[model samples]
Target: MRVFLGITGASGAPYAARLLAALVDAGCEVGVSASAAGYEVLATELYGDASLPHDEVRDRLVGGLDGVTVYAGNDYSAPYASGSAKVDGYVVCPCSMATLGTLASGAMDNLVHRAASVALKEGRKLVLMPRETPLSAIHLEGMLRLRQAGAVILFLAPGFYHEPKTIDDLVDFVVARALDQLGLDQTLVRRWGQ
Candidate 1:
């Protein structure tokens, strides 16, 4: 599968990292784009620094991962900017409310938003993993608008029925769900009746 992953300025870097690793392991061609604030958040949360350069941050995030390409957030010329690229799915892990509103408003001002718009217009699978908590009415309305537009509004809420043991386990639970939405089978977490 060809997938486009967008990282926005939201909490849950672990979810984004795990999802990318899972996508590569699943043999999917993945394209990635991260906003400026997204880079800083990843650096601080995952790498213990907030001043990492863009290239370095990208390197560290997808360093040893294969089948992944990183694009500038504002690069409107990327293949994902158009529906003709045949991208099977697009996911915005840790999707920020700002990004959500942009997409809901039908304003493709950046590569991430453009890719999502393409996915929606092409009737492709678009999964949005928003990690925000206590969503406001505006947030809920935006999510509803996206859902009505045929996007999967998957919240980053991990289920505890799997009995997670650590933070990584919790992250895996959410990433596993996202993978399932992409039609990727994973043994990261046990099934309900397995």
Candidate 2:
């Protein structure tokens, strides 16, 4: 699969990292783009240093990961930014409410939003894994709008039904669901009946 993975400014960096790794492991060619604040969260959550520079943070994030390409936020010429690029799917892991609203409003500020817009306009698979809590009416409305537009609003809410033994387990549950939305097979978490 050829997929675009957008890391937005949200609180679930672990989920984003895990999902990126899982996508590569699934033999998918992944294109990644991180907003400024997305770099901050990844540095703080994964590297324990919020002061890390963008290059360092990105290096550490994709150091050993294969089949991945990183794109700049303003790189509109990238393939993922266009509907004619033949992208298999697009996912915004740890999607922020701000991004949700932008997408819902049919506005594009960066590659992430543009990729998502391409997916929606082209009728391709688009999974938005928002990791928010205490959502306001605006957030709910934005999500509903996206769902109505044929995008899957996969909230980053991990289920405890599997009796998670660690934080990784919790993250995997949500990642598994997101992968499922993109039509990628994952064994990160057990199914409800299995």
lDDT of 1: 0.91
What is the TM-score of each predicted model, taking all chains together? Answer: 0.98, 0.98
Candidate 1 has what TM-score? 0.98
For model 2 the local lDDT of residue 153 reads 90
Clashes of 1: 0
**Per-residue lDDT of model 1, residues 66-145, tens digit only:** 88999998788889999878798899988999899999999966788889999999999999988777899999999999
RMSD of each: 0.8, 0.8
Model 2, 1-194: lDDT tens per residue? Answer: 99999999899999999999999999999999998889999999999999999999999999999999999999999999888788898999889888999999999899999999999999999999897889999999999999999899998898899999999999999999988888889898889888
Error of 1 at 95 (Å): 0.1
What is model 2's C-alpha RMSD? 0.8
Off by over 4 Å in 1: none
